[model samples]
Target: MSDQHVYLEEVFSSIQGEGIFVGVRQVFVRFYGCNLRCSYCDTSETRAGNPVICRVWRGCEPGRFSETLENPLGVDIVADLIRDLWSPSTRHVSLTGGEPLLQSRFIRRLGERVEMPFYLETNSTLPGAAVDVAGVIDVAACDIKLEESGVEDDHGVLFKRSLETIEIFNDSDCLVFAKIMILPKTTVATIMPAVTSIAEINPEIPLVLQPVTPHRSNPERLIEMMDAAGRYLRDVRVIPQTQRVLGVL
Candidate 1:
């Protein structure tokens, strides 16, 4: 493995809150950078500066972050910590971010060192980087960013890149799925382009519509969006942020 180090925000054990893997236990290794700024983002703090220290939830207790480790952590060190936090029911070690693909090299090395499965939670805008780490990924929750959700993709370049990234993962051995964040104002027209593109890639790929948390969710809108998706896709489901409802980290 290479001696590459990664800037991380936190290392914690928590329920998989988003996507099809919701409620599954995971060891979350949150990296510290992102290329996009979505208005409904919950972890925007991760997008700013490199954290000097990473808060680690060391025990089985959820949200009980009792330890801190110096930043720019090595792959071996991160692997060890993940092993320590992993439980019998732990489904995978989630390489989440502000955009984990930003540190693709570091993730490649971590994949080499860590025995557990890697679940990548990414904003699918980095197909090149996705190519670099795709072999190592076991499951991918690729976000399909919608314009109505305040994703700043003016020219739709990022949207195209997102589809490309998803395609890359779909071609790999990794189990891949598309996740779209639905805001209160998100309409069928707002999501059509993304939904149609995903269908083009492979309609069989499961599509998850996640309502943005803490907002007044429109159930009717979600139903309409799902109906629209059903024309091009086979499996479309509405799954909100269950971890937020469970009051876990």
Candidate 2:
């Protein structure tokens, strides 16, 4: 991959619908590719195949993508598109993806050309990649995959990697938070280890329990999970994918 270019799925502006930053407006730059194939992944299209053209939405409106750019996109070109999509209330440039850390080099370069803080949304399974881009990241929304999420981590290697990645960003200047996607089947036993690990790292780090979209979590189960997390972590909140509710990208 060239330092000047990156594979992108799309560029748009919308409210952040996950993590503790839910409802915050942002310019979302969706990079392509991912390492993990979670059962409930909504962005599977970006996980494997490379896109031939990148969809750059017009302004911050949903479903108003009046522009399209060819891939691989130039870093400066993406910076300009982000600037064009930014509003006074836009909090940061959301560097999201199938897994943004896969293209950490491009993220570092893009961060150089953009003024807004880089908010990285990652799977938290690549510690080395995290190091490469941690300096430029302002907010790290690291995902903790549960066994029930259909991620094939037979020996817990992926979970260990996630913890390492989290530690990297936590030690950096970035605001680090752990986000666990809860399914209807997600139990207290499955989530406790992640919460414990995060607490061991820093009890001050916020934890966001995002119930996978379209699959309503059992209220009782969600409460139990929150209570369990609260005992270890200082801050815990339940958020959902509101972008789908608002019909945005």
Using lDDT, give the best candidate's number.
2
TM-score of every model versus the real structure? 0.95, 0.96
The weakest ten consecutive residues by lDDT in model 1 span 56-65
lDDT of 1 by residue, 70-92 (tens): 98888888999999899898989
Q: Which residue runs does candidate 2 get wrong by more than 4 Å?
A: 59-62, 153-155
lDDT, residue 238, model 1:
95
The TM-score obtained by model 2 is 0.96
**Model 2 per-residue lDDT tens digits across residues 90-153:** 9999988889888888889988888899999999999999999999999999999988889866
Instruction: Candidate 1: list runs displaced more than 4 Å.
Output: 1-3, 59-63, 153-155
What is the lDDT for 164 in model 2? Answer: 97
Native-to-model Cα distance after best TM-score fit, residue 234 in candidate 1, in Å: 1.0
For model 2, what is the error of residue 159's alpha carbon versus the real structure, in angstroms, after optimal superposition? 0.3
